[model samples]
Target: MNNVMGIALSGMRVAQQGVQVAAHNVANLATPDAQRLQLKRSAVEQGGVQASVTPAGVDAAAQLGDLLAAKAEVVAFAANATVIRRQDQMLGSLLDREA
Candidate 1:
């Protein structure tokens, strides 16, 4: 059951990360330097999955390291979903303006 718990925990953690990266992207939508932060995930060989966030233009690494620190993760959880949504709106607006 421990392994199952680990898997569950990992899944939750990864989902949270996804929401977080999106939030970051949204938060920076107005920032000229922001390039859409994206969250990357990799399956753990043994139990669960791991997640990391990087710029949209970055190449996907086949692996995820200890990139997200504990404090960062907490903040990410706080605003990730909202950030991503905002970013999406901003992107759409920019595209519409161009069109």
Candidate 2:
């Protein structure tokens, strides 16, 4: 149960980082020599995931793709949040039953 919560939280964090990277890339699209940013994600050894920001190409097409990917990440973040909310509700119900 706790593991599930941890995983969901990590997922949300990764999605957030992805969005931030995408936004940075899109925001600097018109700036000359502005290095694009990318999010590098990896699974944690114990559980969950991690993300890092890295430099990428300044292609307009790739930046658009990043925006689309950011949209997907928003959906992923919402789904993870839903999981956490449901888990909390279930735990509350369990406690209510015990009482």
Candidate 3:
């Protein structure tokens, strides 16, 4: 149960970082020689994922895709949050019954 929460929290954090990087790329679309950013993610050994920002090439189509992906990441973030909330509720109910 606790592990589930940790996994969900990590997922939410990754999604958030993804959105931030996407936003940065989209925001710099019009600037000259703006360094596009990309979010790289890797699974953690314990349980969860880690994200890092990296430089990327500038492409209009790719930037648009990133915006779309950012929208999806927002949804993913919300889903992870829901999982955490549900887990908390379940734990509370279990404790209540035990008490």
Q: What is the TM-score of each candidate against the true structure?
A: 0.53, 0.92, 0.93
Q: Give me the displacement of residue 56 in model 2, in angstroms.
A: 1.3
lDDT of the candidates, in the order given: 0.61, 0.90, 0.90
- lDDT score, candidate 2, position 68: 98
| Candidate 2 per-residue lDDT over residues 1-99, each given as its tens digit | 899899999999999998998888778777888888889899998799999998885564896698798899999999999999999999999999999
Model 2, residue 99: displacement in angstroms?
A: 1.0
Tens digit per residue, CA lDDT, model 1, 1-99: 346556656766776776566566556555767576667789999967788877676434411322343345656444545554565677789889999
For candidate 3, the lDDT comes to 0.90
Report the Cα lDDT for candidate 1.
0.61
- Cα displacement (Å) at residue 76, model 3: 1.0
Q: Which regions in candidate 2 have their CA more than 4 angstroms from the true location? A: 58-60
Model 2 steric clash total? 0
Of candidates 3 and 2, the better by TM-score? 3
lDDT of 3 by residue, 1-99 (tens): 899999999999999999998888788788887898888899999898989999986565886798898999999999999999999999999999999
Rank by lDDT, highest first.
Answer: 3, 2, 1
List clash counts for every candidate, in order: 5, 0, 0
